[model samples]
Target chain A: MTEQQTGDVPSARPYYQPPSLTGRPQPANLADILERVLDKGIIIAGDIRVNLLDIELLTIKLRLLVVSVDKAEEMGIDWWKHDPMLTVRERGLDEENRELRERLAQLEGTPDDEEGGQDEGDGSARGRQSAGSRSRGDA
Target chain B: MSDMPPAPTSADGPEPSVPVSDTATNSATNPATDTVTDSSTGQGSEQGTGRYLYAVCRRLPPGALQGVHGLSGEPLELVEHGDLVAVVSTVPLASFGEDALRRNLEDLSWLESVVRGHDDVVQAVAAHGPVAPMRLATICFDDDAVRARLRQWAVDLGYVLDRVTGSAEWSVKLLELAPQAEALEEAEAPASGAEYLRRRKAAVEQRAASSASAADVADDIHATLACRAKASRQLPPQDPRLSGLSGTMVLNAAYLVPDVDAAEFTAALDELRGRYPSLLIDARGPWPPYSFAMLGQP
Candidate 1:
């Protein structure tokens, strides 16, 4: 099995290239193209006035936005300022975690089993609210 | 095996049995003619037909797109305005109509085919010379509207054409793999619940600091890339569902580099790869400057 896998790796790639880059639509990794057109913000001002008697042109947001584009970067509501890569939801989660961490630190300062239990329970509840144990990788 | 004669019924959606009816932007001048579809209840009627603008280029050869087709198999043609030309093709009102669009756009498969068709046409135009690709589904009432819109945005379009004259776009994705945790594993578990929580807190802090370093590495990568390219734009990290890759994406960036400097860019990328072997640096490009085309747009 190991030998076959190794044989497939080097031989599979260069022998048959990724198709002619010019004019050919490679279907496997089209998400790149979709992201370019969708998220890259193309502005089309007017001219498409086909009457919409029923439905409005609706764009569904794939993920929940903790903060909008207006204040996503500014106002520092973004918890993941330490890393610009994190999404709004991920940053929001991190922000909550950071607060909890600080609170946990404070709780540490003053010995209180009851409050600590309460915080632990809260963290567990939040964990449940998020997908699985730690969806930090996803968020 | 790909990108030739797209599935005809792909983006058209289930063909609307009702006769097409909608108002084009140029409803004021040319009233509805019975030849085209215009059977609305009580709306401004301009036979729901329009030219889908694909891209704009300068002085392209006549047969540049000898055998190319637009979204739903309309033969590609050019509408010339002075030396500027807008690559376009006819789109049926019934399908491209606004209500239809609202429905079609939501269908990922339909949207994908349309976007693919649009990109195919733009890529065909870009092959001949520098082309400024328009937004997907940029519609105009007719050849006149296409010319008018091109004329109106001539200066801005000219700027875009010039900006991307000999440049191409490259995508660079940085994915951060989560670090594995190794506990002390002394005998059994912690004694009390608070003790367990305390240990968990320590682990979380360690992970945070580790990820902080990952963030710095990502910044360094972006900075190095930006310095190499003519221009760089930071796109939002894609959802793993969309990206189809493991690990949290640290950076999603597109860089516009001169056609001549592409080799150097790749070499720099390779060096960075050597620097951070653990981090996945997925790079692909020579794409027609989609990220850099909005040169003069506010």
Candidate 2:
């Protein structure tokens, strides 16, 4: 029975400090709880079928797939990451387009002479695609 | 499917579907339907109301929760099945229904409130005994359905409870951004356009190399921390926008550590923090055994 286990164990005031770079640490925020419950908890789910006559909806699967990227992969759920509909897929395409433009510029004998250069384009993006896409376009 | 533990035998018969007292139905509806209230918590009314389960625990004394409220300020109630007690509350069917969830799940603020409500009760339970949190928004058609689920998952639930009884979770994140760009003013202006292009490409390549090495360093640190805990899991690094942090997030790891061993774990973290002073390392925890409370783990 250590000091860490006692006190309000479930209080928002966490025993461990929130990391500095995470901005203002609100202890356990929505992400923390979500990450925990999504990965842990026992899900006891069933459709609530109302025995009514007036037009009402049928069964629905309400299981939320909200998980961090790594957690999703661990559970074999990476569809959205690869889904052609979402931003992750679109971002990949955008990166491909940018690199092709850069290469085309290079072939046209123009080496980013435009003001602010290619660095400006990179600075505007806070996207994850930039990191992984570098592998393909690298000469 | 492969990860699922051996399925427990369900309730011996169709003895589920507890007939919650729907006083309104006694005077109005068909007797056959009266026996089965579906999932609507209102019992007799067609209005879709059901109990939203937040978490489950064992050996929790009655009235342990007197003031806890769940989503939309509903009184939190406990449905006891054998030794297991599920923490739940009534929620409007129109709001929590499948169609509503499709719209509401995207609303972060709504999700946050519901999660907070869920945590308030779950945490109350965890403080006293082993608790296995349910996924966000698990609604049961009725108390009987909840009981059926309890019977269906009794074995796995017990396993989770026993493992997390004396442990807590910790999150460790590592961020190492590319090193500051080297001041190239010292180099004389390049004599040729090709020379300038070559230099720029080299700089980009150098930055990439450092980022690659930073990732390797983060991996090394995660391995070091994992060795100090009862169990460890690697979660995907959070997006910068979501986390409000700068730099590449190299590691997002969670560890299940016993209360007594927590000091040692922190000590190891501090040692690594000292070793990699330039890296941004965030460690948080003493959380309920979230990452570890899963089925099929020894």
Candidate 3:
């Protein structure tokens, strides 16, 4: 038996891992397990003779459909790259920036140029001064 | 039909009235009747009765699985029609019934356990013969309800079983890339821009060549292994994140090999590993044809 087959030799920790982006209790071997779970499988649902629990309360239906994640990725849903947990992750700096933009927009209705000429001149002058400072700092 | 409890009888005869367990006290009135009231009237107290779902299989071995219980304490019973057997066990209606599933399906742990358990029973039946696993949390009201399903889906379920019979599933994963000294050359700062460009070009070409060689190795490995198997399909590379695996996944393929050649199939994978030092080929299997079996297939 080779070292690989035995799986005994110490190896470096894996970089990419499974079990959802967020740490949750999921099948350790997710890819293999999911191959079976997320396929065109069987579904069973029946009539309820009782009228006690609410429609939202008594009926629990199982919907199983199979689509490969690779297919989903091929569709260019690139959000998984940025957010592996998808919608489940804690909001970070990107969300903060988005919130700030939204708040700014809500407070100040869309900005129309009020002092357009003066704004342009001041912006260019500030840019030149900042460029000079940046070059000096780099040097 | 009038909503009344069926009078207590011990024969295999159909009753027009709703069937209720004898245990329901007058306070509870009739448990089966109470189940319907819970559904329509939106009242609580229909707490404990759950539908016992079973495997949806055609021509399942009769009397094969007896005295089996669901993960919960509900007694397992066979709901059959013609050749199909639904190995079912009752569960708490609040949980296994339709409404609770929609609410709890989003819970990852609950979903995983239920899916795993469903897979486990399917696997057991599949081991004996072609078995069509039910979707996660398929709840049926009673044996008659299960038989109705079998009759309704007999053709689809039969098609699924035919595709999987005389086949087994094997998983082949490519080994991770072992970093080489050439990577270090690229990492080190180049002495000049021209030299830097040259190094970068070489690095790109090297990577391309490496990938090409890995593909070649995978092809060679599959060719040799496929010779000993019935059919082979190369699935797309899996995300390391989804697989919890180390390194890149170069090849994720499932092969359906005849049971007789299973040993030879494994040996072929081992041989490929020995022959190719540039590639890592890992194989595991003889599992139920999970990847290949599908209902309503062409």
lDDT of each: 0.59, 0.57, 0.49
Candidate 3 TM-score, C-alpha based? 0.57
DockQ of 3: 0.14
Please give, for residues B150-251, the per-residue lDDT of candidate 1 as tens digits.
Answer: 668888888788888888888888876554423322325888645765665555556566667788998999999999898999876664554555455667
Candidates 1 and 3: which is better by lDDT?
Answer: 1
DockQ of each: 0.16, 0.16, 0.14
Q: Which is better, 2 or 3, measured by TM-score?
A: 2
Instruction: Report the number of backbone clashes for model 3.
Output: 30
Cα error, residue B140 of model 1, in Å, equals: 1.4
lDDT of 1: 0.59
Q: Candidate 3 residues B1-298, lDDT tens each?
A: 2222112122342321221223222212233544433333222323445444535555445444443335453334445566666666555657755567555565656756766666666666666776666655665444445566677877877777777677777777775463542454537688754455345444434544565667677777777877777677776454454456554455778787777787777767766767875565656666666666555657
**TM of each candidate vs. truth:** 0.66, 0.65, 0.57
List the candidates ranked by TM-score, beginning with the highest.
Answer: 1, 2, 3
Residue-wise lDDT of candidate 1 within A1-139, one digit each (tens)? 3445554454332222222232222343556777665444234443666332221222213322223332233222343333334444345435544544544543554355323322333444333332222223334
User: Of the pair 1 and 2, which is ahead by lDDT?
Assistant: 1
Best by lDDT: 1
lDDT of 1 at B75: 62
